[model samples]
Target: MTLIDALIQYGLFMAKTLTLVLAIGLLLIVVLRARPGGSGDDDDDGSRLEVVDLNGRYANMADTIKAATLPPKMVKKAFKAERKAEKARAKAEAADKRRLFVIDFHGDLMASEVGALREVISALLIAATPEDEVLLRLDNAGGAVHEHGLAASQLLRLRSAGIPLTIAVDKVAASGGYLMACVANRLLAAPFAVVGSIGVLAEMPNFHRLLQEKGVDFELHTAGEHKRTLTLFGENTDEGRAKLREQLEETHAQFKAFIAAYRPTLDLSKVATGEYWHGEQALSLGLVDAVQTSDDYLLAARAEADLYKVRYRARKRLLQRLLGADGARALARPLARPIGSVARWLRNLGGARCA
Candidate 1:
């Protein structure tokens, strides 16, 4: 072969080697950029929970970007601006159409965290116009008497304002839960969601037998005969038992009468039997009006008027904030505190078993 030909072949070999190396480097870079579970990346948007301002402030669709899921620190930021924009947009759009406010009530029915609920309801009552509707997404299995009763009273606030209230139950709304549902002008439920247990129950244990075996006598003193009918430590007389039973019967009667007043059309004799029915069966029994889920209801009504979900932001307790201090000390000794917590939990378990 000629020397010039050999030189040309050497040049071609070098060019091929350089191109292969560059291609491999580009592949590695692409793989590194596609890593999973990134913070604030485009790929992570769908998996992240969004903090939506239902009140109407950030109307610009682009402004509602994938913000970081709300941490305690971020939640402290005022959502007032976003809420204002949303409200303006809603008001403008609702000028020609009817609107509805859909609210949810789930989990244990108690007045412990009721302050937040009252605030949300008060806001809705003030913002709602005469043409707007109020829909409650109620799902409660019932709890303490006075607490549930107060929760039910909050629903009446909307009614008293002359706003139409509709209740949609996706799951169980029994006992005190039904007390709230019955207040709505119309009630809808899913096919299998438990409904109606219009009754009250109270149960307590009497340790009289155990105390007698241990030779421990307990004394009782009361001003009235009914004040201390069923005692936990003292023997219960027939008169005391009779009195307790009478009290329960009276409460049950009052519950039935209350339901009758709200729903005069319901057959009081059959529904007051303390039995629950599913959605279709409940419709036949007059417990609910129709079968529908909250999602379908919202989607169907979206084109008619602006839809807003009402919920109260839960405040963190002082103790939790104190323990979760934001400082170098917290980061330095995080494991120490976590280990101590586990140890205390184990100690409590052992003590409970021994007792």
Candidate 2:
């Protein structure tokens, strides 16, 4: 085919894709409008822990362990004693078994999974026993400071409850991701997983010179001196730059403290130098405790306990479901005044009806 024909075909395909996406989006909006807040579960009891037995699927595997696969050779002499102790055996077996609860947190720039993590931890706290353990599968390249900080605190909830928490980093856990990983009692990572980027970063595009050339005035008012430091359109001064650096340093210090509180063996001064190490390197530097995939850990623990993958699937707001995260936020500011506007309109309509 000629170059022009190929280009035309590609353009047609993209247009078709866009059209399909728009159709789906509109269909979703119609569905949401038909049933708003009708999914039920407006109470705390709505969120529940879902448990799955891991051994059921892989029971025949070579590595599988069964406590009583072979029965003791029963003779007529011992048959009477065994019959009498049958109920006692059942009670003893029930007391010996423990549970393993699993959760997954895939973080982005905003660390949105923290909300669900909080709910999952709260639910588990009520149902989990002291012998039971929690495993978190974490995957992120790190993002915002406060966002990941809060996400880390959610993991700390498991620790505060004295529940054994293990973090599995299959791909990457750097910066804010590492912050949350450190809160776990044990950290597992893939052999080549990127881990341990303990640092701070701030980047902003400055259009001050362009504004100057265009003779545009951008005035920023603030209550504090360092409140309006580095900005997009404003001319940055040395004092503002220094203050920004100071704030970054302070945040970094807090990050270090958080890591230290959990994993006291690590020397943060060395590994927290703003560079990420791979899983094996991280183990040598005391960043991660072991090199293992999430699958490997789960499969190995299957024989010991009843493993359950827990999740808190929160119902999204009507607007959010229709427009998604970014589009919802983009339209949120304008929609904030709707309640007052509707109330005022109803009052005026009532007055007119009375007249």
Mind giving the per-residue lDDT tens digits that candidate 2 earns over 4-62?
99999999999999788667656655754544356544565334445555554454342
lDDT of candidate 1 over 260-306, digit per residue (tens): 77788999688777788888889999988888887677667765666
Candidate 2: lDDT over CA atoms? 0.77
Local distance difference test values of all predictions, in order: 0.70, 0.77
**Model 1 spans with C-alpha error above 4 angstroms:** 1-94, 109-113, 322-355
lDDT of 2 at 27: 67
Whose lDDT is greatest here?
2
Clashes of 1: 7
Runs in model 2 deviating more than 4 A are 1-50, 57-92, 316-355
